[model samples]
Target chain A: MKTEAFVFDAYGTLYDVQSVSKITCEKFPRHGELITQVWRLKQLEYTWLRSLMNSYRSFWDITEESLIYTLDAVGVESDAATRAQIMDKYLHLDPHPDCHSALDALAGVPLAILSNGNQGILDTLVENTGLDRKLEATISVDKVGIFKPHAAAYELVEERLNVKPENVVFVSSNAFDACAAKNFGFRVAWIERVTRKAMNREVDEAEHVGPSTMFKLLRMQMEDLGMEPDYRLTSLNELVALR
Target chain B: MKTEAFVFDAYGTLYDVQSVSKITCEKFPRHGELITQVWRLKQLEYTWLRSLMNSYRSFWDITEESLIYTLDAVGVESDAATRAQIMDKYLHLDPHPDCHSALDALAGVPLAILSNGNQGILDTLVENTGLDRKLEATISVDKVGIFKPHAAAYELVEERLNVKPENVVFVSSNAFDACAAKNFGFRVAWIERVTRKAMNREVDEAEHVGPSTMFKLLRMQMEDLGMEPDYRLTSLNELVALR
Candidate 1:
């Protein structure tokens, strides 16, 4: 299949969201991993909740709010300076190791990011990771005032790139985003970073699974939503062969 | 304040959803607690997801799908019969210990249930728990083709009870439901079953927090969604004094 533009979901697809755990660990010591997992989950939850309630907030605002909730819920106390330091990590999340190599492989292919992140942070994040040099545009859900898996958020890709959904290979590591993109008629590539078999083996072997394992068991697996992605790739490197 | 009707959320408010853990433990052995927590969380996620996607499915369908997903993710194998047996528990979830007394306390006042459950299941579950005698109506989001946290779902209360939002006391132990109900203009009474102070104490006291504790941390607290419930009560019994 010939793809027009490789439109990607920025957070999990291109960048390493778990990279935030580094700063979290430094600041809160043992609670880093827990906070990281809960923060991301709540951040996504806030988007869906707001979208359903017809109350739209910027992804940045949602990120901070979810962080506060996570810290409070995790029983960690943090002042403004510490919180700001933690929040600042979003604008500089490390890109996945395979990101640059995969982008380089698809050199001539038109590339852009469609993210739930606001435009300012999306632009800053891409630039910080040196990914901006490789991409054409960084699209944010802020344009549509709703987060994906909403159809309107997906429409931003077509409006910005002048490419139809069928022509664009929308790639996301997030199961919900991938399913929603496909449901919106995009040729979706879901990055299956963690396989079900691997997860099952871990659960079977480990006597006691931690919060991170539980998070994976709950959120990382593919959703049972009727829509499924067109392609299930193990990593961004696989995107090159598809194109 | 004069309340026109007292509308309660079915799953976590009037009923104890964790009661299903008894059956899940019987079926899955050691993995029952994990499955029960994951299943409930995913069940609620599916409703919000479907609502946001404009892909409305009955709560019963969502419940089954989430269970299937949870079993697979947890690496436990189950046949249709076992699955059906487990699903059967929803219809007979134990009402909270305080449920009947709270209903009895407000005998002269109008009482109803506005739930994400479908009409048939809602009716069946209420009757099974013997809450049918006390509840004047069991309102379902199925009628609205969307789940709670959506404005349309809350409108069903007014349509069915003919009570204005201001005069209605929407009681929910589910934080999202309570917040959304309040956002929808009801005088929401959030049953603070698991307080943040208690959650923090648990986190501080425990060396390793379990999935149930994490579930409470992630979900049981009031959301920072810019809408706060009108009243915060420790138990459903406290709901009596409000009237």
Candidate 2:
């Protein structure tokens, strides 16, 4: 019944992955959005595919690989400048508006980030977002050579925190990540941000899939697999109430 | 390389899953296309998700479950009569025009189907489409309790046919399946039917993912992981040339 520590997913949960859209749209006005959509999906897919294949790649490498594929697939010219700009955008992803206050409210609780990002990327992201002071530890799945949804990724928390899996309250904006953590025996809190709808719907709309079918599939997968998130909320700020 | 047997993926490769459109259009009238796209994606997603979760469900149940979700998500009503009609459509999927001639040409070589379909559904599909006589065996993953892309599912071929994986020339229209078969040590022939382009693009266009980014990702995954299909052809009729 008692929670010992809070674990967070970095991309799309604490930080806005599409914050790069401004420069992306400026660089390639017509294809920027599709580039973002494809880039993000490929980033995650590469992780699972690698894990399933028993091959390993750092998240940083996967991010660049996916970005290259996105640029080619969307017919964007990926010059050196454009590549550098986008990669920097990833390094300096802006935290969600609620991030600071939510963590501030839960300052008494030990906080950590469990991310697919390599250690260097997580350190840069944390410092760039001014989250260094608030976070007790930042654990990267790079140590395990596999990505999230793999039980080994979750085990990093147990190893680092020295706490039982039951005592960890993992929070993620992604349903699959939350479901994976739940399957790994963590009490999960799913942060359902409002902007998440726009991202899901716009990507689905652009991909020509149904309005909400992608997100719906994620939820359905979680439900069908019997790994429902312990709690869902519109904002991470709601976590303060739990504390 | 001597291919002693040609093993096929039943659903999308041999049987046209979209053949259900005739009756679906009659019933839904307005949302038939979107329903088909969403239904197929959800069906495959369920299998992958279940495999990742290590929970298995019969493809029949997964097919029905995806249909129910598709109907509800797309705002179509799913009455008992409607459900029965759509489910019946799956049992009577039409095989591609090339299926007969291709198998006929390869009459000297043993032909079999290795599918995610449960035994009953595979039997019904084969019997309904008159493929029973042509197929030497219909191998279902039901006995293994897993779906395609999993090693265990592909093992069904070896177990049923008593052929080494290398001696079986595995064919799948789905790139992920092709990649998995390749990884499992089968010399794979990927059937690149023209309509596959429209289906991949439409689904991507509808799901708003990309023109063919999903398939592209599968190919990329295979390449990045060092598993590549040995051969690719435009039609099943091309199989005759292989001999």
Candidate 3:
């Protein structure tokens, strides 16, 4: 596929979502992992719920709200100072190790972030990680007042980059986002960073079970929903090969 | 607040979603609870995912798809006969202990179910549970080609009952659905059956911390998203008092 531009999901694909785990683990050694897991799950749920309700809030606010809910759920004391401290950590989240090198290799492609983050927060995220100089556009779905997996959110890439959906290579660590982008007509790739084995084994098992029949059934299901990811990679390092 | 019509959410509110736990436990003694929990979570997720993808599959299909995914995730062998047997359990799911008496007490009001279930499955479910004689309208969103919390799904109640939204009382055990119904202009009651104390305590603690100011803030957050549930009751029996 000759891709004209590459649009990436910001939070998990490029920036490691669990970067706060180090500080969090130090603060509450026992519940750090649970907090991180709950926070991220609530963050995603809030976005989808807000979208379905047609109530749009910036990702920053949703992040904070999710934090409060997480703290309450985990039976932690919600001290204001600790809350502000964690919120600050979000602003300075470190990028994944593969992020810079991959972006450097695909330097010629018009790159942008099509994120749920509001314009200001995403702008800071790009600049804080020195991705400001590397990326061509820092696109926010705030312009359309919705979140990812929504067609309009994906449309921002084409709108900002002035490229057709068919020409864009959209990448996300979130399988659902990648599937949504594919449904929106983008050639998509899912970065299977954590459960790489699970993804590979499912395909392999399907193939081994009944020749192409099982594989065909799986593919047909994805095709039926326009959710078939064009590629699955363990890291962004693999994107260089696609180029 | 005179309720001219009573519209209930079927699953989790009227019918116990965990009714299959008994049989499922006998089959998979070690992993039954995990399977049930995962199955319910994935079922809700598939609904939201499918809605966003603009690919509407009936609730029956989504239920089965979630079950398949849950079984695979748990590394259980997917047996065709076992799958069909569990699905059969769904059709004859027992109503909660409070369901019958509550429905009987409110016998004069027009009662209906606003659900995601397709007509056939819901029809069988209602009839199998003897809810057919009790409920005036067994409405399915299948007619609208969408699912619950969608404004259109709630609109069917007003249309069929020949009543205004203000005259309808929408009751659900699902927090999200209760909130959605409130947003849709119904007098909504949330049946806080399982986690009643937790929900009440959160609001109470928030209030105790800073007078009604904290309560106001908490309510405002819910109000902002149209998620404010007007009444929170521990049981359907309490619903009778609302009359």
Candidate 4:
């Protein structure tokens, strides 16, 4: 009930997949869509499979497996050479529109990114996202050798931040993770990008999926907990109200 | 695998959560959103919970329970009158765009709808979507007292169709059901909506889910000894191609 610090799921929560996909996607439109969707699907699958298989790989390594597996699943038949570009992009995604400033707006509240990736990958992400200096710390599952909802990954944040699960607001873009964390007794927040792609030109009227962005997700999380932000903003200026 | 028939999971597979929400979502748009989301979250939860409870309710009854539970979960302040309207609209949801024609096209395939719903509600849906008459038969959990992905529900279809599991082509919009059926050894066809829904300008894009007609999901059950669709359709019309 006492959320002193906030913990976030990195991949889909803090960064956007579509944005990450820009490298490959911007080059080949047809391949771009499949690349992002399949890569993401495989990344998640590998994370779970590694846990299920009792083998743990760093997020960077898993990114490789994800690319390979995604290509195989979709029958894209990519060679390792072409796949390196896709895997490499994972380290350099743009921070979501409101990311840094939004965190900046959180006043001095400690913020952390917990992931099922490796420390090296997390470091790269931090550097790319520019959160290395802004946020409190970064946490990854490599320490526990397990993915989240496993209690281990969640515990990693607890151990690192010294914040109890109830005191840490957990935000994740994955639905099952929210369900898992909530069930595990964390005051959880759902980032709401449940499915793979944004449904893009597919459904301009999808009603549930598309370009709502994470602002609403963050808003819903705040509303669910009855914690009104210092102020709501379309830009970093929203963070100003906190100051 | 020889498929004598195809089975579909209702709510998310053959239909969608927002599709039904369209009728009942106006009351407390905010609460309505939670209600719809949790209503869905609970339907699956109820099925799983009841499965674990070893006490079962028809999915229809469970849906009602979920809706009310969702209202409570999100703190919806609605009176009895509003609740009644939402409940009625649930069974009256029209099929997504091509549902009627899709059913008409699948005539020879001997399809059946297997839902957690009660027979009465199933009958109402059949009458409402008109997918009722076109379907060869409708099977509700009320008969067997079990929900889907449960081995028994799958068995009901096999028993009714007088075919082996390998001989059934299972179609569902619920991705999990499709995965479940595929894992359970049925020929699974995913009905991916390839259509798009234009935004209703009156609705803010933030609230706009976008796209009434969306890309219907389709994963053709393959020749792989493992996954096969046997048939795929955007509208049921593709069923004619089965011949």
Candidate 5:
């Protein structure tokens, strides 16, 4: 496969979204993990819901809104200070362990992040993680006023990068993103961070699974939406082999 | 409000979707509640997702697919016969206790169902529940090839019923549906079946909430999507007063 550019989904593919749990737990005590799980899920849902409604809000706004909803849903009273403190974590999300190495291995390729994140957040996040040095561009759905899984959102990659869909390897840990990218004609590599065996075992063994495990069960697995990714990888480190 | 028509959302509004839990419990033992919750969530998600992806599958297909995914996620093995037996429950979903009385109260008003369900399933469900006598039309997204929250889906009501959006009082128990219908210019009545106080109490009192309660926590509340329903009522019977 002659992959011309590697376009990654930032939040889950290259950045560790679960890293927010550290801060959430610190602030909310017992409710941290649940807030983290619900916050992320609601964040994604808002994007889809807004997209379907043709109501375009910036990803930054959506993130804050979803956070507020999550706090209320989990019975935590959130003030301006608390909300601001938690929201700041998005700008400093820890890069996945393999993120730097994988980018370095494909150093010569035109690497960029095509994320549901707003450009300001994406830029800050990449720079904070020292990934700005390797990444050529940090694309945001803000440019198009819609979120991922929408065809126009995927089209932003080709529009900005000057690459055809077939030549770009769109990588995402989100099953819906990978499916949509593939459906939009990109050569997709779905980073399967959660394995099927692990998922089944978690469900079988745990009488009451925690928020993180439940998140994996609901969101991490591949969707049955007819579009399958060209490659199913366990980690971003595996992307080097494809390069 | 000179109400020209009353268009109801079928699932969770007129029909009690949770009633499927009875059969799911019978079929999957302890996993039934989880299956029911996950199944409903996934089913709504698939609609939004497929709509955004521009890949329109009939609601029936999406329902079955979500059920299969739910069974797998919950660590239950499902075969074709098992799937069929469980799916059959959709055709005969129990009407909410208030459904008939509410419809009956608005005697002379033109009544219909505007649903994401496909025509075949909607017809059978309405007929099986004896709602067909009161309903002049069972409007499915099948006619428009898209699901709710999309303006196009709501536009079908005006197209078929010859009723303008402002004159039609769109009633739904689904918050998202109510918001979308209101956003599309209808006089939307959101049936608040799960009260905010009840939801908060459920979260505060329970150590680990059940699937049904979790569904209420996650889905039953009004969205922060800017489009609020014109009226918020605790029961369908309250809708009669608005008429």
Candidate 6:
């Protein structure tokens, strides 16, 4: 397809969620899990709710809102001290082990990190990972609150990177992030990592049987692209090396 | 609100996503992440896509389809043996630590697991987690392929649990799942836990935001129930201890 540039999704893909999580998670050993639980849950909810309502906010502001709601829900006193700590940590999250190497490998081509996050958050993320040196573009929808899959977000990358969605290799650990890029016609890659997902089961209440998740959407896209997954799976480093 | 019973959202709320993920992730390290990534991405996409396209399949089958496509995308081969291995694992997932104990605490109540999963898959999950042993009902939307947020799936729970929407306290870790339950007039509880959420980074994504998340949806619900978070956190034992 003559792909020239690789566009990456921020958060889980480039940076380790655990790394950012460690910021607040390490503080309150008691409420650490709950805090992250609230932050992520609300962060996602904020995005979806914004989309459905057609409202928009930068990921940073929403992150704050999520934090606020999380605190309130958990009955934690919403003090400036706690807020500052979280924001500071969030702003300087560490990069995934594979991030720098991957960015370094794709050094020559135009590479971008297109996120629903604001420019500030994106920059901080890249800078924290120290991979900012390699990026050709750092795109974010600062003016809009709309997230990915909305077309507008990807359009920013399209405009900034100046590459056909079809010719750009978009990567993310998030399935929906990839879906947005794929739907936009970008050649997307999902960097799936084994996260230490919590094992707290408050209630195995009603289980979900929704449609295939975003991750599955990529599968459908791969079939259309004639891409085949290797039965022999390898670590991200190895896979990236082979690629 | 004269609530009759509380129905919970299963997958993200009560049960861990790993149940289905381990099916593939264990066999293929990256495959687990890829499977979860794809499955989640596609599942959410399918819901929105089908909602937009006006066609639907049971969440279970959709899960399978997404798996096939994801396997192909990542270049992972899902032969009969591999597929069965992954598929069978769904029937034997280990419950989260808090699952059994909480189920034990809520034993006397008319608790149920409502999902859009296939009858067989849900049945198998129930057996695997030994969840059925603690609950009064296990509801599935097999008769209707339309998943959560769809009235039909909710109806399955309502019909089986014999609880009116308001009378029933619906618990789910999924924001959309909780929102839908609330929309259906059920008293919903967003289970607070640490789980990766599928997002496109939109602010409005909050529509589906589960109450229990980085913040603590459970705490929010507890507030609704006139209960306080007063240091009541952790496993079922600790939670009940507060009570």
**Best candidate, DockQ-wise?**
1
For residues B134-165, write the lDDT of model 1, one tens digit per residue.
98999998987998888999999999999899
lDDT of 6 by residue, A1-243 (tens): 676777777776676554545666566644555467546645765665455434466787778877776655555555788688877777776677777776777666787787777887788767766767888888886655567656767778768877777777677666555545665676666554422121011111213311122212232133322222221211234334333
The per-residue C-alpha lDDT of model 1 at residue A145 equals: 96
Instruction: Compose the digit string of candidate 5's lDDT tens values, residues A146-234.
Output: 88889999999889999999999999999999999999999999999988887888877877755666578679988888889999999
DockQ of 2: 0.23
In lDDT terms, which candidate is top?
A: 1
RMSD in angstroms between candidate 3 and the native structure over all alpha carbons: 7.6
TM-score of 5: 0.98
- In candidate 3 chain B, what residue range of length 10 has the lowest lDDT sum? B211-220
Write the residue-wise lDDT of candidate 2 on A143-225 in tens digits.
98977777888999989999899988999987778878998899999876634344434434543552223433333222344
At residue A59, what lDDT does model 6 achieve?
Answer: 80
Report the lDDT tens digits of candidate 5 across residue range B86-168. 99999999999999999999979999999999999999999998998998888988988999989999999999999999999
Deviation in Å, model 6, residue B119 alpha carbon:
18
Native contacts matched by each model: 0.71, 0.05, 0.09, 0.04, 0.47, 0.12
Question: Residue B50 in model 5: shift from native, Å?
Answer: 0.8
Better of 5 and 6 by DockQ: 5
Candidate 4 local lDDT, B1-243, one digit each (tens): 455776777765566556656645688664444346545644664565454334566666677766665555344466778878888876776566656666666677788888777889888877787676668888876777766655677778777767788877777755445655776778777664432121112122323222221111111211112233444555545645542
B48-92, model 3: which lDDT tens digit per residue? 777766778999999988788766654567588888888788899
lDDT of 4 at B25: 62
Error of 5 at A130 (Å): 0.8
Task: Find the 10 residues in a row with the least total lDDT in model 5 chain B.
Answer: B209-218
* TM-scores vs. true structure, each candidate: 0.99, 0.85, 0.87, 0.53, 0.98, 0.51
Ranking by TM-score: 1, 5, 3, 2, 4, 6
Question: What is the full ranking by lDDT, best candidate first?
Answer: 1, 5, 2, 3, 4, 6
Error (Å) of candidate 4 at residue B169 is 2.4
RMSD of each: 0.9, 4.1, 7.6, 9.4, 1.2, 11.7
Ranking by DockQ: 1, 5, 2, 3, 6, 4
